[model samples]
Target: MAAPDPDPASAGDGPGPVALVIGSSAGYGLAATLVGLRTHRMRGLGIAFEAPETGRRTASAGWYRTARTAELAAGADFAFLRDDAFSDGVKEEAADLLAARFGKVDLLIYSIAAPRRTDPLTGEVHHSVIKPLGTDYRAKTLVFEDSAPRIGALHLPAADGAEREATVQVMGGADWQLWIDALQSRDLLADGFRTVALSYVGSDITAPVYRAGTIGAAKQHLEDTARALDARLGDAGHAHTVVAGAAVTQASTAIPSIALYTSILHRVTADRWQTPVDQAAALWSRLTGAAALGLDDQGRVRLDDWEMNPEVQAAVRTAWDRADTDSISTLADTDWFRDQVGRLYGWHVPGVDYETPAETTVPWPAPAGLGVTTHSS
Candidate 1:
């Protein structure tokens, strides 16, 4: 839980750069927002769809994280919008807000991961699935039952043509393109405006259900969009697809294979493992010309270098091969994986009093009507 070191160079007399982070309540989105606010001293606007706490039930983790982020950004200019990013209305609202509050956007980070998306143009809803294309996929996956991890076999049927297209529509870069178009039309994009979209390319162990699956198709579409955007921006700005490493996030837990692979990854990497925030710090440095831009053959940023290392992949493969119900605990870092998962929901965090009955209703700093919840600091 170590914080990233602040960059002294970013301190200046002028107002800092303005950043717009879509899906900024959790995962890489949240990490990127923190890096912009904490390290780069940037003004930021975060967009996310999250639920507030109701009676007996707790608020979504993103809700709590957003509140904490607002608390942390006490002195900075920051705001969070709780709305569906896929809708035309929210897009217009965000654009208007940026024009009035920030004047221009220097950086735009697209890191949304949603299961369903409604097409703004056609009013069609697309639901994304995590199945393989053309053929069935069967693999050994890790499942958590009754707070315990167990190995299980998963057999997923192939996605049909319609389903594959739907998956791409929901998870792909179409929405990212739309967002850029929206901002550009409003003339709110600053000179040298930079944009990045997060992506993943896991090891061979989880390729079938990840990089080679229906989700992969969507990611490929996203990458293509990035290239198109790069050319469109030309000298005015740049766009890139940042390939991130596997880590425990809310989305990853839903995918059985990824959960298993990440558990083994944590074991293999151990102390060397980097969290999303750590990667975001490095990314911020690269984006600001403070660090070398490690671009792959496709001219995209590479944050998965550690996870894709030869030795790391080999070890993961070895463990994945021998993984089963009995040997999983020995082969993978299940404890670490579980702990990370709990932290996503504001649980198992150190220095938090779980026994105390804290306030469940916490309000966002701006944009009234979005209810709130309390989270332990």
Candidate 2:
């Protein structure tokens, strides 16, 4: 689909650029939305697949909606759309809504992660499994639910080429293309606009489960999508994917052995810098206008500064190599652990009173259920 004709708002004319964030109700998406509003001073829209009534404890955190609406009250024209992007009808509905509300958008961020996907091209639904490549793969997996550590072997399902390709089609480029196409069709993109999708190139040790796994294949497709978008933008605008830092996120929780990685990441980044928020501030700065806004060496945004830092990477590698059950537990600074979790839900913030009931309600209209049934569309 081609972009709609350039409207008056299609030109960058105001401060705090208009933005849209897909999957912005929790974790990294929520953090990005908050940073854009509070730090970058941008007006925006947020879409999430999970609603408060979904009854998920993590999804019900009123802070997610609160942050979005409060930003609107602060003179930023904002809207919240709730729907599953995987569903075509829901995606179209969101596109129509955006077209009616704001005829043009200046920025878009795609931050979504799911385990299973229904391929539109093929009549099959694919589910992802994370395990060691060979049979002899064992790691210390942290039991967050029980607050204990146990060693176990992870066994992943064998992959079929059709299934792997389907996974990429559903989880990678298709949905992003749909959203951008819809926005363009409705005349919702301003000239010189930028769109970014979040991804990760985790440490080499996790290459089996992350960088070269099913998720890795999906990320590669996403990177390709970014490049395609970059080409589509031509000289009018730019689109790039960013390999962000390995912070503790809900998505990170699903990856096996990520706890150990995140533990070391927390320690290294905190010691090298002050907090994730500090790194996030720098990240948002580049996203907005702080650093020269452009792609890095990997043809993606270089937001993974801490992860790519030579010292930080060396330290994390050393920790991963030496990581055992007890060492993994003790190696990570607990103070940083508590701080990272607190920051996840906007707790322990400096200016915000965590004690007071300062309006934690906003509209989230999607299902927070990670267990969506995968069926071919």
Candidate 3:
């Protein structure tokens, strides 16, 4: 397909400000891409690892969502490289793609969530674990068992030996730093450019499994990387961490503990609930607004301000005390949780016909002829 004409109000005649979004399929990455194209008025280059449509098996939700983003983009340039963002040569190919379509990227959003990662240089594979750091973590986990919302206690063991290190390798901000390094090395980053890595730091109820878990260790590393990158920008760009709210992401259902937390979080948050897309818009707004990015005492972006409200947490804590097998349905917004998850797969989407079959295969634009990276380095 021919590329859409550049938006007239661009930084240059080359292309409108570009957004290079890693892990741009479902959840926060995809939502950020929407904000980049719509609010930031930029071209999009999304990187993801969705398997292509097979004979019977269809493409992943990331694939479908990217397609929909292109459709709704209307006269805006959008392309997706169905590739792994964690490979050895992935960054080079991304630079090449950006060079071909949009010159320097103004925004880089890293929102990848995966089970494992590989050291592109050594080819050593590292897997991430969901466990507490020091001791056993006992939390009231909720799930829809056999169509009914139920709560139960989950005892997550601590990560031992190299488990914490491996988890950090898999989920930490190392790759994010590498990405910025690559972009900066090739002069692919525009002046005043920005990059953000999404993370979650919930209340103490889920801290052991989340904020204080192996993943938490990784997030700390991410914040450290952000601090370094911010200094490294040298007036040309900015890098930071964004703590997002709990939402029904594509992977949330698999983690029973998170599912329960989000369910109760939804109830406590009530009508002020924020979706993945809403979070994206909020992040974008902060990025583009005149007031500088608000930083907490620790110097990190806090997009989860609404979620961390004392009133909300207080109510959630009260509900936490009453959250039992019999009270789950009443205490948590189970219906909303389910509906949000459904929307990920084209279900519960407004104006979409659930009873009919739709086209499942669509070609993604490849201006640089750069294809996807299917395997780890």
Candidate 4:
């Protein structure tokens, strides 16, 4: 989508909207940051944990993406904190930076997806797992054989009680709540402040391993927390759980059944699929009164409307049923799926020369350590 021209009148003697985006290095978080800066003309801070290039290894894709974002945000009020968002130290540091720089935050985007979390309160660590709840689940999963995509049946054992609890602890809404409370404690939330947490509700085909799985349990807690947070914000602000559609992200590709499901879904919904940036643009339009807020029954902003269409789902179901090792290539769009994955890591992108030796160590524009604060003017 083309970015709208910034309106000088909107900056009336001050900055535009101020946003605090957690997990902003990649995926939805990165998309939201770009939309906020380019489309909405908002000034913001982004927080993420990423590693720089070592002796010979290249920097994380997120690092390069953030550097590109910094380049795009030239002459805009923005900064980035490369540290753990879950720690109290980083939270306090972020709060201080926001207070000093922007005075108030108009929006908060929480899209963190981590494998493990260390609780600051009790010093306990929790790890998340991707397993079903009740009986064992067996399904046709996609795998790469000799760099070629293939379909095979896979068995996944049920998650134990402790495993379920641990997953919830790691992926649940507790961290989001903590962030809100921290900002509230510092009186950093502006009037009409809004917050959103990204979520997904898959189709019945992958329910056993996804929506009805342990991660789903955590998402349930996340949605519940949003409701509670909305009530807590009352007249001062609002909170919502944005139900986004299936897409190939670094986090989504790691899930067991998502790759296969997304492949088939891509084939079924060819030419109509919405990337993360598209969804972020639509979301910005809704949030900024540029478009209608298409809310679902549970008060969620439904960006998955096309993905959940009856005919599209029916086609996906048919593809899933007929998918086998012999016909998988024709049944699913595995090539497109592989390309998306490659793009995530800064590879296979068009107009880029892979034969040329490029700079591997890219510096973050505004680098912040644990408790340091740096800003780009």
Model 2, span 1-377: residue lDDT tens: 01112223322455567788887766566666666665565665777665353334444453365444454435545655655666666556666655665557888888888776555446467665544333334555544435454334455554566656655765677778777887787777898888888888877767777777767888889999899988998987788887777766667767887766777777777665423344445556676575675567768877666577788878878876776655756666544554555655566666776667764345442223221221121
Stretches off by above 4 angstroms in model 4 are 1-14, 367-377
Candidate 3 lDDT over residue span 347-370, tens digit each: 877777778887877665443334
lDDT string for model 1 (55-122, tens) is 77877879888888877767777778888889888888888878877798999999999999999999
Worst 10 residues of 4 by lDDT: 368-377
Which candidate model has the greater TM-score, 3 or 4? 4
Ranked by TM-score from best down, the candidates are: 1, 4, 3, 2
Identify the runs in model 2 with alpha carbons over 4 angstroms from their true place: 1-15, 54-59, 62-75, 118-126, 131-137, 144-163, 273-280, 334-377
TM of each candidate vs. truth? 0.94, 0.77, 0.90, 0.94
lDDT of 1 at 362: 83
Q: Across residues 1-377, which tens digit of lDDT does each residue of candidate 4 receive?
A: 12335545432445669999999988988888887887567776899888877777877888888888878877778888888888898899999988877788999999999999999999999999999999889998999888788888889999999999988888889999999999999999999999999999989988898788999999999999999999999999999999999989999998887888999999888899988888988888788767897888888889999899999999999999988888889988888888889998887788889999998878876734323453221
Task: Report RMSD (Å) for each prediction in the order shown.
Answer: 3.4, 7.6, 3.9, 3.1
lDDT of 1 at 271: 87
Local distance difference test, each candidate: 0.86, 0.64, 0.78, 0.86
Model 2 is weakest, by summed lDDT over 10 consecutive residues, at 1-10
